[model samples]
Target: MAEVGDDVYREDPTARRLEERVAEITGKEAALFVPSGTMGNQIALLCHTQRGDEVVVGEGAHCAYYESGAGAAWSGVQFEVAGRGGLFTAAELEAVIKAPAYYMPRTRVVALENTHNRAGGVVFPEDEVHAIAQVARAHGLAMHLDGARLWNASVATGRAVAALAAPFDTVSVCFSKGLGAPVGSALCGSAETIAAALRFRKMLGGGMRQIGVLAAAALYALDHHVERLFEDHAAAKVIAAALRDVAGAWVPAPETNLVMVDTPGIPAARFVEAAERRGVRVSAFGPHRTRICTHLDLPREEVLRVAEVLVEALREANAEASAGMGAGTSAGTVG
Candidate 1:
């Protein structure tokens, strides 16, 4: 592992190196390392806005629905949800900027998630980002990006991560997600913004000492693992194609490493249980939709195995349902 001195005092050489690299990649003046992507994004919000402020975010954004309301609790900022699929047009944002009304909280930040989680990991187009940034600038609102899966977006779209991040005032990127590092996230921004974020990080109990070990892993991933995300994307599309042929299975066209399959006419929990029994693991997202993620840890053989097990599980479920109906029953349980 790379070695560095204590980081709580900001002397860790490896951490500094990683921060500097992240800043260069994002075209930011500075960067700070945080424990997780959520922490990185939340710290940025806390540092950028005061209490009683509002942050505009997509309805399906991780910060809006999945971060356990940290923006509200830690930053004392309210969320103004934009749209169902976590997409907002520039016109939409312009309309939402509050007038000079004392009753409404001022919208201080506009946050977006690239490769939107609930939208089947859809990558937001760069033009949309630029337009929204223009609106944010006109309103004096800072823009932040929850770029946890940004590397995947870059690989899938053939766009540099910096190009996507350039329009935002701050961006949080993760190494543990698609990058396959064990842990670490970097928040990149202007020097003053990062200086303020470092303080908020300390207040949020995110300060660490001698964190070069984790930083080293993150650095390694950024160097060696980013280019291979295209393979994961290809694997996801393969899984989606396989699921499309399975009876009672619905798979959306995948854009990244995530594949969302809808097991219609079959309970998703049962599908997951059956898949696990076959030594393939998957998680149910809703009553019908289940999410399967392809990662560096999961090899191509494992991906194929998952697809085979899903097909078998679906076949068994359909047969069981058919047998039950033939026997004049509603449905039958499969062991």
Candidate 2:
């Protein structure tokens, strides 16, 4: 029923229903579906700012490092990255915001990530989110939440998704991630903002036909998959604990479904390569950290396997590093 008609004409019943459901979940006036989270975020920036406008973001935010400069390339805007770990204090936000002088690009938007990915899936405190929102409201700047993992945050914090979304002018959530949908994301905002976003999505060639198939999967995930995230969170913490004190690499107990291990002497990329050879998939975040993320598809045995793989990889990296140091010292003495 959803894909039977066209969405560009607002005639796809399933897509329309999915949009309405997302809006209600996020407590927004309206919603628009897009192909990917990147598109959803880029559309938000495009709708919120004009050419030369500045957007403030976190130093390790997806919009900053992962989006390939889409904010500047497509929105014709520049970005100012705030503090590390994807959280900035109200004062920090205020400090980065520029006065509307002719010489400076006007700061039109502030984007935040909840369950910040690069920060090892740290959840932003609710009060802290409100404080940042107050600053943005005070300065007449718009707020956007890169809430791709907000479902995980909601489950981890035991907070309603609407409460998490309350402070933002726009919030984008992903279905393709832990939600287990094949492909889709939605941008929720006021009716006016979504209307502007609709045009921007089309402008970016994001409008799709028969999106209802994907929306159906997302809807199912919302109903069935959300409550189960606690399982992933628990498993991730277990994995982190298991890999603790392995080769000088320390895994912080997971806050959500992501576990980050701190490698002291070895780089995360090298560890990732070594772990991959052992049949584990992990991503290198910053120079010193490697991250393991748990989702619906990752099984208990797989999580255990990944933990073992990480331990062995760290041992290999440590041995290699010690050997390199020994060789360097021997060469120096020989010289």
Clashing pairs in 1: none
- How does model 1 fare in lDDT? 0.85
Span of 10 residues, lowest total lDDT, candidate 1? 326-335
Across 19-113, the per-residue lDDT of candidate 2 in tens digits comes to: 99999999999999899999999999988999999999987888867888888799999889777667888888989999879999999999999
Best by lDDT: 1
Clash number for candidate 2: 1
Residues 1-335 of candidate 1 have per-residue lDDT tens digits of 68888999999999999999999998899999999988998998987899999999886788877788898898899988775677888988887788868898989999999988777788988898999999899889999999999998999999999998999889999999898899989999999999999998999899999999999999999999999998899889888898899877878899999888776676666666667788777776666667778888888777787777778876776676556533221221110
Off by over 4 Å in 2: 1-3, 325-335
List the RMSD of every prediction in angstroms. 4.3, 5.5
lDDT of each: 0.85, 0.84
Q: What is the clash count for each candidate, in the order shown?
A: 0, 1
Model 1 misplaced regions, further than 4 Å: 317-335
RMSD of 1: 4.3
